[model samples]
Target: MSVDGGHRRITNRLFYWMAGGCGFATGVVGAAFHLAVDRLLQWPHWLADRLGTGPLTIAAGAGVAALAITLAYLLTRYIAPETAGSGVPEVEGAMEGVREVRWRRVLPVKFVGGVLSLSAGLVGGREGPTIHIGASIGAALAEWLRLDKLDFHALLAAGAAAGLASAFNAPLAAVLFVIEETRRQFRYTFRSYVAVIVASAASAFGMELVGGTAPQFRIDTDALPLVMLPLFMVLGAALGVLGLAFNKTLLMALDWRAKAFARVPILYAVIVGAAIGALAFVMPMSVSGGERLIAEMPVADLPLKMLALIAVVRFVGTMASYPVGVPAGIFSPMLTLATTVGLIFGLLVEMALERSSFPVPPLTGAAFAVAAMGGLFSSTIRAPLVGVVLAVELTGAFELILPLMVTCVTAHVVAQVLGGRPIYEVLFERSERLAGRMPSVRSAVTSSPVGIDDPPRSETR
Candidate 1:
């Protein structure tokens, strides 16, 4: 018994070391992929400036964008279908043992495909894809090294936390995100928790080394007015409704595309790509994933009418792109929409309160926008704690915790009243259906009886 205990201790230490190393590597690679996509997206603007605008120039730009998006979509459909649309669901499904993590194919496909789709001005973000891909990489490495099933799961979660940390530079939030968002199926343990924290910290450090540290969004510190709380509650309610509609529309669109273009994913991709390209030419702001738009909101000072129009267009574009099976995320686009709505609401409030000579603080709306971001996500996904932590971490706005809680809780309550289920739960159910139709791999790993008090198998040693 003494000898056995000593051996177990040694094994545990080794597992921790491996998990840390894999987490660090995942962080570095995921950060690199994000930076590369950013640079690639800027290339088109540089090219347009160099070549004088004419029919030929316009046609060339459109053709390039279309081809790039189509190719990206095709790769996602053919090579790594699971990498499609904000891979959070995929990760959640994998955690539940309802989906397989084919890291070998998924990592490369998601990295390259995500870059292409975003560069071509598709409405999406890299956060979801990065997390999914990073987790797969961890899982693959663990399997290759013949790690135990528990350690494999821990490392996978660590990699996922690292990816989000690297992408958003939100270390604490990444850890909280994994814990809160994936609470149901994630085999949580002390070792896994520590692994997630270590990975997130390393990823944040890596991002700072490469790009320098800056919060994802900058906002002035201002308390939300008491009067505005009611309005915010109203906004939260509206977002709850919008969240439900968005999910339904997105799933329907994907289902329709699958049926209409059965076995012809390539052709369907081309059509979606062309539509995005055309939208890019016409409503440039609405074409992309909305990152640039969000960054420029303060400077633009868009009027209510224009903001309303943009919000509508963005909603449609996001729905179309996401359901078409593209490898992208909805986080950035949702932020964009929230910002638009918040700004419009602020502008109207400013007009009504014209009696005050003080400059209408733009930060008020920005704060609400930030909070609404989490609120919508919480409402749709039913992960309030994750939403609050994610928003705080991504934005680096610790002061807005109260507002975030308020908004998220309000939105969640309203969504629940509307009878909406969590988005990931729905996806997991879908994955279970698929899993049931496939062969099981239970023979590959030792069958340890899991008990109520048994630590999740994914924990390190």
Candidate 2:
């Protein structure tokens, strides 16, 4: 090989190493964050058991949640405002050169604030904070090593993939998420994306070592019959409508919060946190991220009315929780809400089938619940492939892939027909307008065409 070729080969290898190392570290950190949040989450239930059912027990729960959420909100408000909410939009903006990562402030604030807010029984997912934290870790590494702008960008994407992989224990889904969800922002190149793949694998490895190899949600069922495909499509269309409403309501709540609590935002946090915490006493399923509820759905014998009530309560709680200026995400809550809606549909179908004397399995509702996860995700995120893969990975429900695909595709198409935009993209634009800042005119990295054989320049940031 020519000298230039040899140098390029070595350079690619080094870049891969850096990306993998960053991913591994992110996985380690992400696992610890999950474990810590899980442990902290038990506190409220433990307290409830010890205190018994009474106004004092409720008051204690409310006070603790209020204090935790308030502290978390203050950290983001004073230390790093960009760490507010899920931080997904911020990371996307940073990728487009429109926002700064501010790793020094972001890393610590996001970690502690996320723990406090999520463990306070706020209805939000941990994945968003983990994604932001992963990107920040990549940023820190790139800055310390003084890599080129292109490498820095690549590392950020890799870190994001690693974060999701660790969060869901789904490496392939993580890679797809970067490729599909962040496609607009991510700089696509063979080397860069391969680095992403490597990082995702390493992150998944680290996550498994620390968090065990079990799927995030464990529910299994037989393969869905092709005859039932139309039902899944209908389910998808329903979820599309739900997704549109979800985005609209969330944005409306955010706007209202901005106008009503502009000066005293912390008060909003106190109210939301206290309300949710107290409600946890009577309705624990409606207050949390809903992972436990989702896992238990296969066996839980909840009535249809109770399911509807839980869904409504969770929908309102999620809308209230996210706008409290605390670190939170909608992914987990979205999954839960979709599951409830799907199970409702499934139960209704079973009732109709029974009236007609058709046999229905006990686990059929669970099948629909699993498929709805991908459907709603597809509609909300506008990334059908990622949604399908994520659901399959999270549940290990390979048999449901056919239904998942039908649901995701129909959901995507229906959401588009309804003129609903991808939630993250809308959020990014709104953030830019709110901050009164224009996106930077200069692109971060320019390189050869996506699949070409060229290395990025060595210019330092």
Q: State which candidate has the highest lDDT.
A: 2
lDDT tens string, model 1, 253-372?
Answer: 767776888877677667767776656655688887786676577557677789899999998888778766777887778777876776776677677667676456546666766777
Error of 2 at 255 (Å): 0.2
Which sections of candidate 1 miss by over 4 Å? 1-12, 212-215, 355-362, 431-461
> What C-alpha lDDT, on a 0 to 100 scale, does residue 174 get in candidate 2?
89
- Measure candidate 1: CA RMSD: 6.2
- lDDT, candidates in the order shown: 0.72, 0.83
